[model samples]
Target: MDSNNTNVKSNADTILIVDDHPSNLQVLFALLESYGFRVLAVQNGENALKIANSILPDLILLDILMPGIDGFEVCRLLKAKSETQHIPVIFLTALSETVNKVKGFEMGGIDYVTKPIEHRELLARIQTHLTLKKMSFSLACQNEKLQQEVYARTRVERQQALVGKITEKIRDSLDETQILQTVTEELVKVLNTDSCQIELYDEKLTMATVVYEYIKEDSKEAPREHLRYHGKVRQVIEPIYQQLLKKIPLQFVSTSLDSKYTKLACPIFENGGSKGILGNLWLLKPSEAVFEELEVQLVQQVASQCAIAIRQARLYEASQQQVKELEKLNRLKDDFLKTISHELRSPMSSMQLAMQTLEKLLQSDYPHYKSPKFARVLEIFTSSARRHNRLIENLLMLCYLDVKSEVFTSELINLQIFIPEIIQSFSARIQQQQQHLLIDLPEHLPLLSSHAASLEHIVVELLTNACKYTGPGETIGLQARVTDQAIELSVTNSGVVIPEKEQHRIFDQFYRIPDNDPWQHGGTGLGLTLVKKMVEVIGASLELESYKGQTKFTIKLPNHHCTLS
Candidate 1:
């Protein structure tokens, strides 16, 4: 035992000896062990093959006359096995026959030795074969390393080529979806992955959207599509995302090895300032493969290209949005000017006719000046002038409201006291139109904090709309109430049912309801738009509900500003 232990510790290379003769096995084991070779001795070919497989000896010595199996057959079996095929085999025989020697060599033996072995000659042959085995191993290792390097270089070149093509695609198009789809398809081929996906994130980075996905044609799993990952998927991916968010250029194997899939994530950064993570370029494969350094580098480069494309696409979209807004603004300006021209001409023509009538009245005899018809001409002149002046005043107020100036002064207004004065101003017109005005006012109502002029304008526009839409003898209703969180003021008119579709656009400048008789309600169409702007400036919400011959406009104000007492 001690001798064997010493033999094993003395040399790193191992030798296996197979012989049926105990004497031959002992002789070979002792001879090899003495020369600092670790040796295993067996009495038959069966044990020899077993030990060879278990310990993987560097060389084997076989005696031809074995009981169960002979040296020739043993050598054939060893040569066939992948693990033992590289081991050098030498045959031991006492036969002087040249035919046996030739047969031994035919069975994969390197050399044969006679039974009366010369120890020095035997040692020299063993040494020679062991040295050859050592050289063979070193050469094999070098060849393997060279092949790997060549393969890696070729792979990198392929990846770089793919990147160039994708870069060209990105440059040629500003379509984000198309670029991402191309990236996933190309990446799946380059990485030789079963599946690939590119994940995009919202500006908040709280959600991950799978923008593009690709599954191999031969894959058994159903194909996945662009989807947002949430719930369990989010929980699993969030930690990885956070790690990459902090160290953007990170590449590490995930710790969760139990998962069936392996993933590589690369951050996509915007052009400037950590605009947060735009998204991730994710490569997925079966867990068998560890992510390689070359793959990491390729994904990083691809991610950068994708980031540039995404930014360009986003910038283009923003420019398009701005262009649309400008076009809409220009259209609004043109409409405003046209409406102003028509509104002004009507009032101007009326004033001109009144002036011509006054001129005739003045040229007539002195007695005619005191006539009732002459007096009626003066009244007509006065009414036309007042109407013209009111239109000018409304236009000026509109101009003032459009400017972002400190024109609005908020104050505590008691609707119970302030509303009646407005109603009184419109009373004569309401009576002339023969419409019934119903005021549903709550006693001891709360005082509202708001811009007085803005509020008055809003209410006046609502009442005027109610009167204009209602026929003679139709009822106009005004109601006010206080809720737990807000003050609600509503004005309702019952007569005409405004079409549901036109209700939304009623607050737009120069947008009037298309009525059969538009001439009956003469308006510049700026009244509701001006009122809407005033309400917005004063921090109130206005909602209009028109259905079944009743139209109601409600204004809601925050209760915090209202004096409940």
Candidate 2:
């Protein structure tokens, strides 16, 4: 459009002429040229239209009564277009009548002069209209400027009122959804638009979602998801977000937004901070109005409010998570208290009963013939007393770990020296049940620095449970080895298989397995629980598994140095 501006060294207007007569065009072109006016000459109306569009000459000397599109038609066509209408036209002809002048007027002839070729009079009329054209153009420009000033003031007032009302509505809303709905409702009311929505950015800067939507009235069809401003505008707006992430807001206004609506994205910022894009405000028709300077500022304010509300909503959600954790801790405290009570009372009752039974035996006088059987029963009774005392001891150790302090008696002991002797102590039971004891302790193993008594008890408990649970012909195996961070002692027994599901909860206090032959085996259910507690007490670790007609217990002795102050 600016192609014909012609180096444009200084401010000077240009004139264009169209005529078929060579003599008349040459003469007129020279005369306008002599007057210091830049002239453009074309032989016919076709060249004139091309040159007119190219140069946009300030004036046109259009000749009527010519071939093709005549002066009357050229004048009419030029007048139809607002871009060309302002270029003054003067028709040169020899017709002299009232009707002819009216016809020239009808065709948008600004002035007409009769031609017998009086050079002086012709120049005078040409000069008169050109001067008048300049004056009229100046006056029209001043009037246009006045209208623009009034429009700008009116637009500012309207934007202020709309922005103010919307701000009030948005400020009243405390939550994300409510704030979004408030902004959308106000925008629909004031902007008089359709399918408007607000989208928020999540903490990770990913697209969260549109919080509110306002569609055009009288539409029953659903809004197309792809056509919505939030979904479609993402790629074009990546640079916009890049600036926003650094906390700087920007305004982008364009009429070509996807082959569809003209759109604006006014970034939202607040008190030295910025969030994401706030204004996806759009108009479907191609328009220059979508990107007014006042509109940019108005939408920027709306953006600022949205950033604040969305950030506040995020903080609210975080607080809700904190409250949930506090509730969980409260429940944990209740469970801990209940567990402690059960751990204390159950062991005390067993020890009191064992003591009463042993005292009765000591006072009774037995015959010499029955002395051995009585002595065997007393041994059984005494072992039960030791088991009860071990229960109380395990509970006390567990209490220390719960409060972050565990004290264990440490000693340098060899697994090679210790494991075989422990198995030998259980030899009588192994032989009585006619069971095979497969021991896997190796000689020249690492010397373990830990409480030897607790390690022995953990291994013994696993072996004892295996012996008691399995049938007579089944084999009980004990294996101990040093693995990466700890010593792993595993005892596997065949004949009786514990259900897989109950394996996990077996360490919980008082948990028991449903024995298939209830008459054959019995337990206080404290052995494994106490085993787990003892391992924790000595800073060791434990795991259990029961599968495929075999039950295995594994205890890992940690190489830990527990020091005292």
Q: Write one digit per residue (lDDT tens) for candidate 1, span 1-565.
A: 1135642665567888888888777777778787778878888888888888988888888899878788889998988888888889988889889998998888788888898888998888988998998898899999999999999889988878977987887867788888887787888887887666677766666777776777767556555432213221233255677677763654454434255556677887654545566777777676678678877878788888888888888899899999999999966865685578567767777776777676666767454556678678776677666666556656656656646436666789988898899899889988988889999889989888888877888999889888877888778999998889789889998887778778788888777777622227566678898878877788888888888888899998887668855
Runs of candidate 2 with Cα error greater than 4 angstroms are 1-395, 404-411, 431-434, 451-454, 482-486, 516-521, 524-526, 529-548, 556-565
lDDT of each: 0.77, 0.69
Highest-scoring model, lDDT: 1
How much is 71 displaced in model 1, in angstroms? 1.9
RMSD values, in order shown: 19.0, 18.1
Residue 54, model 1, lDDT: 88
Question: Mind giving the per-residue lDDT tens digits that candidate 2 earns over 422-452?
Answer: 8988999888878888988766467777877
Clashing pairs in 1: none
**Whole-model lDDT, model 2:** 0.69
Give the clashing pairs for model 2.
none
Indicate the worst ten consecutive residues by lDDT in candidate 2. 278-287
TM-scores, all candidates, are 0.50, 0.42
